[model samples]
Target: MAGTNVLFTVIVILIYNAYTIDSISTANLEASLDEYINAGLKCHTKNPGLALAIVKDGKVILTKGYGVRDLSTNSPVTDRTIFGIASMSKAFASTLLVKLLAKHSNMSIYTDIAKILPNFKFTTHIRTDNANIRDLLSHTMGFPAHNLMRLDPKLTRDDIASRSQQVHSIHPFRDSYLYNNLMYGLASVVAERIGGKRWEDLIEEELYTPLGMSGSSFMTKVDLSGNVAKGYGTDDATGGPVPIDFAINRRWGQMGGSTNIMSNAVDISKWMLFHLSKGRNQAGQQILSENDMATLHRRRNTITAPTSEKYFSQPQVPVSSLEENYALGWKNGVYRGYKVLRHTGTTWGYSSLVTLIPDMNLGFFTTMTGDDPGYKFRYLLHNYIGDLLLGETPWLNKTTLCSFPEPWYNQSTSVYHPINKHINPTRSLNYYVGVYHNSMYGNLHVTMNTSANTLQMNYGIGSWLLYPKGTHDKFVGEGTNIVHKIIDLSSIQFHSSNLHGRSTIDSVKVISFETRAPPVFTKTSSHVNTGNIVG
Candidate 1:
């Protein structure tokens, strides 16, 4: 028996040696992944909770969960934990659309959306004449971001379409890319019409079931069971995790194309494999044809701009390049000499990123339940993994990890005109009357009536309360703590007044005052004005 025990110990030692050797062979890769994990932990100070995965050659080299999944319960995150992957849903939706197109040669991306959903009508302007399947996927249909519908928990897709009539087009049909969710919802409608199935059902049938992505599904009104990560935000002062109230109404689930995807990294990795293999499954199932895959990767335009600083230095992969605009749903670009195809998603409490490097047969998926700070964590992880893959320094230097420079504020030199300035002043008197313009925010016109002492300032969108600061100057009532003053004309030097307290008003510029327009008074009698109000 003693001899047998000694023999067993020897065998265990041999197995351990083999495992050690294997890990050593992949030392650089492991080291790089470790560096990323460290960086991710540091990001929790700002971003809080993060989960990351790195894949190379169809194998997962790293899958890590950093920070807390539920700060209240002190539950840690795991590889199998689920997260809401906001706009990343677009990638999956686009993939399924492409797959359906491949299966039915009769269907093309250029097919008119109107043909699929005849009831679909635009009150503002119809760009559907040139809009095709490709336009929706590429975000080239001239639809302004219609987020109002999503924000309203009570609104449905039908209601959103009804309200869309009130929305105006930013440009003519197919003129430029305007990232809009309305078009995506319309695309989902097309998918349902063509596939004779709901968007979620079609995804399960075409992609999830075949790839064995069992942990992924569309978010519904029901509570997500075990393995789901709760979303968290940080307190501005304490840097502690604060639970964000996420509205998971059924109506929200209907928004499948733009948001509503819930997935785990383990399951998401399989989805990445589908892209890395260029539309094929692990078992040699042809999920998408070569031509169809190529079409998905092809540049639809020439408008590649880094969405953020973290994306700037990374290498681009072959599936897409930023030189050309839209490659299916992926943003194509070059980072560090390699072609890169990537996209990011955000809901109120969740942020997600997906990136693929086709040349290296590598892909990555990261999801976290947090807000703006989480974005920093995502970028840091991506940069670390990317540098490691490119055989660069495995760790990010201090300078490299610094925040990207803020974009320059472009001054609009267009002539300013009041939307409503021809109206008369009414009773309910006021002491406020002046021309207020922040160099940064442009002009604000204020008028006060006889009875009321309340001050009103008309800027873009609508009127805001101008709290009395002194004799002639008032500070913005809203955000007063951040913006201390919104001066009345009397408080400023005759030359010019700063806009938003940032940009300097040009003293030399001649002031051309327009007549005040009538006020469309609300129910509250804070200030009354007699003028013809034009919106």
Candidate 2:
């Protein structure tokens, strides 16, 4: 939520080594790909399963799977093996939205969200009130990533819509990209409001059914067919891959259009073909206009991270660096000088990377199971494939990427004190027990855990055990689990304010809620239902 997910700052830009299109024989292409991929699986990626699908010149060129689907079963991954593609599902949301817009003359991409869903609002900061569908699609809606909002129990699309008013807009409207998942869910809320249909049903009718993506469905239900791949993550203690629980374990039902779409390479190939053919159906009719498709694919928002010209101190890979920008669903940019649109997604135990070169009518979709925190394997293979197809010698490989150290995102950060474990609280635990509420964030409960003789913070996202930090009133939360894996739970600082006449702890700040501006929940009351606290 704070910075780039998986990106590498190459040392220097390389010259485009343009070779003849026929330089690599067609017969050798598949063999070469298999050899390279198999080597990658063995060398550094170490994924349990991976599926790849490629579309070119309006045809499905390749559908292949390698390795076992899960470590427990030893069942080999097939071309049809199902894997969860996380945020890549965003493209489907935006595409379905565009198709819906085609039927409704009253609604357009430029329409303000408030017009479609009257109750929807964003922080009353008038600057953010006028945000339209395009802003949501492109993630330029001004709100920084408020991921914790999605953790509410049995949250509906309406709840997400209602909560937008609470989250402050920290970024510029329609200028900088914020990459918000909740905003996408809020956009889907708008879609359902105007289309008079659930976002799931709308996509199934307009996109999936027509594209013949029979195996693709929302992640809420488990496929009884017994073909689903298990999710994974690396264990911090062992630094080895571990089988993580499903999204269901953490209430995936609350996720609307933001994420959780289960699909196989076969179904996703049809999806790729839809974009490659400019939204044409099998019947040779346009589902969406070429201009609309272009608009969806065109770069609308600029961002830092991989898109910005920044250098990190490390041994680097030689890649062609070019200016890049974010489009609606995909990151519209260049890979080795080829105009490209791409996106990568990672969930509990699955990761996916997709690339599309519209000029060449080429698209690549690769998804894998197991832990890939840095996603180096996916990026390495994406660039390698781009090199092979572009007729240039491949420069990216496992040795170059895997050699770098994986980032440690657990530690909390602050300029004054990263953490002062030596600090201790001066007051009794009972004084801190209360309900702190942020208008946009709703409420967080702090209650006495008499059994443990400690303070427990109850939020929709996590149940944190609070302990003193040496001498300061500020305490740190120990969170072993979270709504989503990536959220970093940090210091919980209690502020003293005047109540009647004497000073008391009146507000508590969750320092990790937002990196730039932490959500300070005021003490609404010291009374709360301890039974309502959940993990």
Candidate 3:
């Protein structure tokens, strides 16, 4: 018996030694990733925080948090700390659509959207007649991010989709690729119609519970408590981020199925793992058939060539970098000879990224709370990880950081636009104070701030102070708006003292304004007159 015991002990020691050696190799790989991620994040000292998770072989292998989640409490971010995942929510909606399509043999990904939602007719039909569920998911329906409609929580998904007719398509349907949120909202309405429930309810029942993503939520019942990270924005002048308030945060609920999903890295890893498993839930249930999975992952629309000379003039990713296309809910591209699936989401104070390399059996999820004007750090970190995992050369270094665009406002220029600092208002500030209306967007109310001596403008989920730009009827405004982008307007004008002007982003005019009668608030006055006010 004693001899047998000694032999057993020896065998255990041998097994332990072998496991230790293997763990040592794994630890080195993890350490490399840690250093690489931290180094990439070091440049953004103003960033409120970040949470990251990496999955391999259907398991979470690396999970971490960096920086402060709340500056006031100096709390560190944790795996469970929630951040607004923004457009990443689209994948969940897409997955749900796939599930619904499978359950209802009558429906198909190629089913025309107009057939599903007859009410979703555009004012001037272009190729909308040919639009389908796949078109909405792939963003080939010919509309550029018309995000202004996503600011009013009061607007239902149907109301938002109805306004799609009011906006013109920048490209012919299926002729050009343009990112759109309204299309996703329209898709959700179609999903609701097919599923006989609210889009959020369908998502919660079909995706969240099945995947065990307890930390995820749609438009309602957001749990920002218990380790949830607060959203924040930066001021280039102060060189730090300030906590965002309800005025801007409210838009998260109004984005419909487009961008409103709040989740943490811990739960998000499950989502990545599900995709890595080719659309199988942990319970061994095939959430989507292999064919449907193929449909979801297959490239449905070829996007602009990344290497086209037209893109060379200030392109986000080099065309030669990767031949890319839009898969159902993922951006499909080639990275270092591997099929790369990825998506990015941005809100006013948070940014998120999810990447999957199915060939390597690896997946990654990261979310950051920052006001990065270009939101490049998320991608930089993503690229560095992809390079490291693929065993490529260290192409990203301190110098690589120089390629990122500067924050919209930087130290050299004034951060907070001082009221009338650059140019004084030619007329009294009160001249610009009035109610502006657009049929698509509910209202914009401008009022004279007596204390600040600036004209304050309030619209769906945002408020900004307009300062004179030294031009008659033209004013400049600078601030972050509700849809999570910076507002740098130079042509905000008041033609005929009625506050008529246009606001643009990326050189595309997205919103127009004009004076209208204020909301009549009389006692017992119901239906105080509303009309289709063309913006």
Candidate 4:
């Protein structure tokens, strides 16, 4: 009896020891996830309008909302709040393309886009007779990143497709991966043609619905019924949050293959799980085939050069690397010793980042409804979460790196001014009234169209307008800060030059303008008795 009692005591002790070890392990994991959340919140406090989520092994280890959804009303953010995932929509849309390929075994990414859109052509640009569909997905078709398309608010996917034919490639096809949103917009058109439905509808039917992402939608104008994070932008002058109201248009929405999708962290976690499972849903339904999944995550291009001189300071290889490899919609690279698959999205007001470390089965999604200030919070959170997952201490400074000095979290009261309202008067109809000459662009004529109240500066196939800024000078029609204050007419100084024909007064050059001269003889020749012909 004494020996049997001693045996029972030994068994109880072993079981208790096992239970304690399991408890410690669970606690450690929870602590790690907590540290990530705390670091994310700290970053959010600095930028005030960010939503973040972290997932590991198909489970949302940490998900939290920080700051207010609407800075104006001071409404707190919630887990279910919707955010514009921006270009992350491309990842989702790309997943649908992969799924379609899996369902139809014969479909190929290498298939000529012209197969779906017969009128599609790259015959005009790069001397190429045609471009492949993969070029559009990989962003190597050589179209300009973005141009006049943004100005035409009515541009559609088909319009973008037709315009792509006129785009000139700087290099041969597949020579380099040049990120182009316009090209992606054109790709969406191909998807529409092949799927026989809108890109949004395809995503809903195949990806979102199957994955049970009920809160996910491709709608730009989000329904206000549930918690919705209002989009914000930093005022260029004041460095404060400015609320932006964007209208949902088909052109923008169909750009879903590139940007334009709204989702909550909860729904996005499901997306992470789907990717982690290699395109399998929660119910074990294979949403995409293994081959398609492999193709989407494969390295398609090699980084031959730094993305920019500034990017050299960072350790990760730029998306410019790899060749013939396509990773569906995600750009695959290594960052900070980890295999990173990431993409960034931006609209006028919102910014989003989605990063996945496939080797570790870890994924992160961060959404900021505001501008650059908000993105600072995102970077901090991303790094901190990464550190926690790797069992390292979080390291991020609280100070903002914004160009301006101001409270990073403060909201801006600056009003939005229309492009027409800010035009300078001197540059309106009178400044460009005379003829001008340039060494490179050649002879030019500035005409004032009084009926239109616009100054037309004609050059080649393109023309720019100098709208009135104040009473003295005009502002360029399409100028961001990067291209702003180009050719300040207020500083123009008149000088006489004898080199060109008779002595003609020339305006002093302020900012460099690159444009060709208008046609010399639009109207018939008029010869005057002064021995001068003005046509």
Q: For all the candidates, what are their Cα RMSDs to the real structure? A: 12.9, 7.7, 9.5, 10.7
Q: 1 or 2: which has the higher lDDT?
A: 2
Candidate with top TM-score is 2
Tell me each candidate's TM-score: 0.68, 0.85, 0.80, 0.70
Best by lDDT: 2
Native-referenced Cα lDDT, model 1: 0.60
Which tens-of-lDDT digit does each residue in 229-335 have in candidate 1? 87665444455555655443234556667776788888888888888887777777878887888888887855634455333332321111233466677778665
Report clashes for each candidate as comma-separated counts: 41, 9, 4, 18
lDDT of 1 at 483: 15
**Least accurate 10 contiguous residues by lDDT in model 3:** 517-526
TM-score of 3: 0.80
Q: Sort by TM-score, best first: what order?
A: 2, 3, 4, 1
Residues 288-364 of candidate 3 have per-residue lDDT tens digits of 77887888889878877432222212244432235478887787877656788888787767888888988777788
Give the runs in model 4 whose Cα sits over 4 Å from its true position: 1-46, 125-130, 248-251, 303-326, 373-376, 397-474, 477-535
Which scores better on TM-score, 3 or 4? Answer: 3
**Per-residue alpha-carbon lDDT of model 4 for 67-135, expressed as tens digits?**
678866888877678887777777776777766655555667776677667756674543244566666
Q: Indicate the residue-level lDDT of 475 in model 2.
A: 81
The candidates, ranked best first by lDDT, are 2, 3, 1, 4
Predict model 3's lDDT versus the native: 0.67
Q: After superposition, how far is residue 281 of candidate 2 from its true place, in Å?
A: 3.5
